[model samples]
Target chain A: MKTLFDKIWEKHVVESITNGPDVLYIDRQLIHEVTSPQAFAGLRKRGISVFRPQQVTATPDHNTPTLNQHLPIKEEASRKAVEALRENCAANNIMLFDLNTEYNGVVHIVGPELGLTQPGMTIVCGDSHTATHGAFGSIAFGIGTSEVEMALATQCLLQSKPKQMRITIDGNLGKGVTAKDVILYIIAQLTANGGTGYFVEYAGSAFRSMTMEERMTMCNMSIEMGARGGLIAPDETTFAYVKNRKFAPQGEEWSKKLLEWKLLFTDSNASFDKEYSFKAEDVKPFITYGTNPGMGIAIDGNIPVNEPNVKALEYMNFAAGEKLLGKPVDYVFIGSCTNGRIEDFRAAASIIKGRKKAENIFAYIVPGSKSVEKQAREEGLIEIFESAGFVFRQPGCSACLAMNEDKVPAGKYCVSTSNRNFEGRQGVGARTLLASPLTAAAAAVTGKITDPRELI
Target chain B: MQKLTILTSPCVPLNVESVDTDQIIPARFLKTTNREGFGKNLFRDWRYDSEDQPKSDFVLNSAKYSGQILVAGKNFGCGSSREHAAWAIADYGFRAVISPLFADIFKGNALNNGVLPIQVSENFVQTLFAEIEKNPKTEVTIDLPAQKITINSINLSEYFDINDYKKTCFINGYDDIDYLLSIKEKIEHYEVQKS
Candidate 1:
């Protein structure tokens, strides 16, 4: 009997170095402008082209401005990075979804929607959120520039097999709870470093009931909790989500892939290195008070008074044991690779449909991809958000990171739906309260930390 | 990559827990194409204020501390997989980082870039911090072949873990790309057989 991760990992192992990392053949390598430049430079210096160009995909997301697609980047270094990616991808024959392309978006979001991410595949990217693709039952994790260069030159990465951990949530989730809340709750319970050396497999009724997009949100934050990646077993939901996408298998190949994917589950008697169980009913719309994701609390809960988080609390201008309710929110950004899918916007719109954004709050909604942006436009999400006074931006990883111009001003508090609430992550001296889009919408409406359930 | 071997030096104790990569080097400074000259901006926000003045309170700015090893709190390098953090550490002249725990990606990045990440027990880390704070001149040594980290002031040491292959690479300055390229045919053969 083998765990789901062991099966996928073993299938991809070309050779194992004695007492060392295995040479793992990567099925897909997603590259972005920020981290791929040095790797491309390394390839150029070595006088080698990408070994398996067809298996690689490149995108310029980290530094691209959300508002302008056609105009040249205003920031000099950012323009240079995007241009470097273009030159490298073009010269190496690697496919690039450049700026303004239909697929140009966050690297993690573009892969799944385009069907480049598949079950039983080994994927690597230079961005930590590369873990987002594990929702499709793939072995995806972030790598450094050297490893990126190795993948480019050999289509393989030398990786050690991470220990397996199975986290089970048996009961049904309560109202107002989303995948973001579930993962946040899990991180709170397990602490940030609990998953440090393991790859987690999310199991049980709670995870099974989630849609592909929601599952992606769950896996996207796996890196936040120190896990290499998190994955769920592929089922009919996974198959349907991947069925007719651009790069998914077709006809006989689809049938063959379906059969292969059906066998991607862990055996009944398979044992994990560690196991933990939580009731789904225990989850609520959660939010982080400290700088780390693991310092989260339930929507109506108080900040823990006893944790070793004095520094994080000071950075956020919060006191231990203080209630976060009614905390003023100066900004509300409801998008990221974590929760930037159609369902996430639907959740946010469900709460913001008939209400006006608070005059004191500046709100933004950035779609994950060009297709997602177009679908939001078609489905009236953009109109609904605009009508409520929320500024809807074009696709890219906007505001979630401080790379581009959409930075949260210094000293302002933002209720963001992005991962990682580290100090100065959104901007220098910017305080981030990580939460779900519904909660962010509630904050946008009230200009304060209000539980989304109250608005509902 | 430079070959990482044994060295003894005084420690720079950050004393902060869960120091994320964003704090190590902010995202705004990551746009460069080359991997050189990141040392100046390492801990950019912490080392300098809004007006680019060095914060005298920061550890790196204090004249009392100078070392090639960064002995920090637990769970160091816990967020974001930017290899830039490792690059910054290596660029800032830290040959090794000793912490009670390390995040996965940062550990790999450090190893790849010739910066050693030494994972010690929680109690040992606490003792090391206490001993170093008591005397800033306290020296520490990491012996690669023996896999032992010692606090010279206390004359106490504990064995650390590093896989044989990585140790071999550290000793010989071997590149992972070279190893992977050596087996490219095996991988292509495996792909063909599977397809």
Candidate 2:
């Protein structure tokens, strides 16, 4: 059966030669500081110019220091990487959003905000979180350094189609349940590997009720579940979000474009290779108990006591039948592509306002981008966070996967809003419990695991 | 330079579904800037014990099979977008990765590195896994020219779609810049025409 993913994939598949790979036309290519150096080196080695400079955009985020953007980069290797991107962009005639620039921020955040991401476009970036753009109804995903080079030199790619899976969330979401909770709940249901071999299309009443930003948040985490990418059909919410954006078609052109995008949904009887449907009310705030994102359970649920997964139990150092409630946390980190946006800050602040942090807990609130930070300050969210003993850090991918100095020490437990709670993801021997920003803030206030619904 | 042709040996069969990039090369190993020597650490956490020792329980450590081509279950190279994951897999001498599905980014990275990633039907993948389990040393042939993979006596063919430019580069062992340089004359002509 031809699913929507298959339909889109086949339409973009240029040609498939016998015993060879398919030729795919790339619509958009995004680059960042961390991975673009080698790609530029590859380009210089061959002395070739960029094939389609206008279609590609580069930014410095992964290695950009969040503490003080004005100061030069403290790490030499990171400095060189950022400099190399600047030089490469200059030489290749590519557009670059340098640090401190108005357009500069996390590649994922900047891409969507700039209206560069549109429905039905195929977007690729050097960062895996590129899937964040899939909220715009595009087939967005990450690529490697070499592939980044390939796209820079030639705006095209070689790709095989993925199987399609439909995750239909029926019914209405319970009160105080945000899109973050919905995705966390879905992750708990599917496990981390449940979506393997598929491009997931999130459907049903619950998805249709979500705002465009909430939909983006849901699609952003699709990669965490091993899906190639996640998409939602373009609807009025999507149209309204892109209407006033910078890159969206304006005036009469926008009306025409919206008409075309309106037809992007799955047919009434569209078939998928696999399907799973659940009621939204069944979902709850979830957290991970093991190293992988798949090892998730409801906030109030007890840890699984099964012996067959003994290795996981040992690594997590968790006993069977133990309730996760009141579990002491050493730290709380709220940031990353997953939950580093303005709404995420508001959610966390709402919980922490007029509250004091637990004596033993250290919390860090890092925004996704400079713009996010600006918005937070304008909303006075930072005051609420600081008053509650949360450290307000600058914008960057801070402590998400611990690429920089911000990391949880060995043997400590942290409740984080970042994606991926895999063993040692934040640091060697560090335990991460993935949660929503609200849940993380709730943990910070109580110094223990607690549901955000209580604060709401 | 001649085109890089990937010849598959059937001994190595990967049957796990959704083999994410984290499993290929974990986030902890991504701290280093070096790219040349990651093959040993490929799937280190999964293939080894907590004491940094090899786990006898892992499939890679089994003595029955060792080959260049990896035949995996579905959704290979999922999770975070670390190019090092693809590099580690390719450096580990796995020239071709056959699976029912692949993460979008990992697929691009794999192909760019000259590692052929083939996607087949679920039934075909299951049959291949079953055959490998029955005979650990069962051989499969991947003919790049024919774009077909043969297991046992049955021959099944699948096509991998790539861009025309990338196709030339892969066939000629030309990286991104090399492909572009080869067309320097054409680019110059275009620039002159625009001027």
lDDT: which candidate is best?
1
Supply every candidate's count of residue pairs whose N, Cα or C atoms clash at under 3 angstroms: 0, 14
**Which 10 successive residues of model 2 chain A have the least lDDT summed?**
A14-23
* C-alpha root-mean-square deviation, each candidate: 0.8, 5.2
Model 1 ranges off by over 4 Å: none
lDDT of 2 by residue, B3-23 (tens): 655565865776766576767
Question: In order, what lDDT does every prediction score?
Answer: 0.92, 0.77
Residue-wise C-alpha lDDT for candidate 1, range A1-456, written one tens digit per residue: 998899999999899989999989999999999999899888888888889999999999989998877999999999999999999999989899999988888899999999999999999999888999999998999998999999999999889899999999988988899999999999999988999999999999999999999999999999888999999999999999999999999999999989999999999999999999999998989999999999999989999888677888888999988899998889988888998888999999999999999989987789999999899999999899999988888888888987999899888999999998999999999999999998999999999999999988
True contacts kept of each: 0.93, 0.31
Each candidate's DockQ score against the native complex?
A: 0.92, 0.25
DockQ of 1: 0.92
Off by over 4 Å in 2: A1-13, A16-22, B1-20, B26-37, B40-76, B92-108, B114-195
Candidate 2 local lDDT, residue B169: 64
- Model 1 agreement with the true structure over B1-195: per-residue lDDT tens digits: 788678899999998888999999899999999999899999999999999999999999999999999998888998888899999999999999999999999999999999999999999989998998899989999999999999998899999999999999998999899898888789889999879
Report the TM-score of candidate 1, chain B only: 0.98
lDDT of 2 by residue, A1-456 (tens): 445565556555545545445545567898887777777777667777788898888888777777878888887777777788899889888899898877777788888877888887789987777778878778887778777777777666655566788999988887667777788788777877677657889999999988776887898888788776898887888888788887778988888878778767787787888899999889888887776677778888888766344555676678877888888999999988888888889988988999999998987788887788889999999999888877798877777777666788877889998888766677666788989888899999999999888988
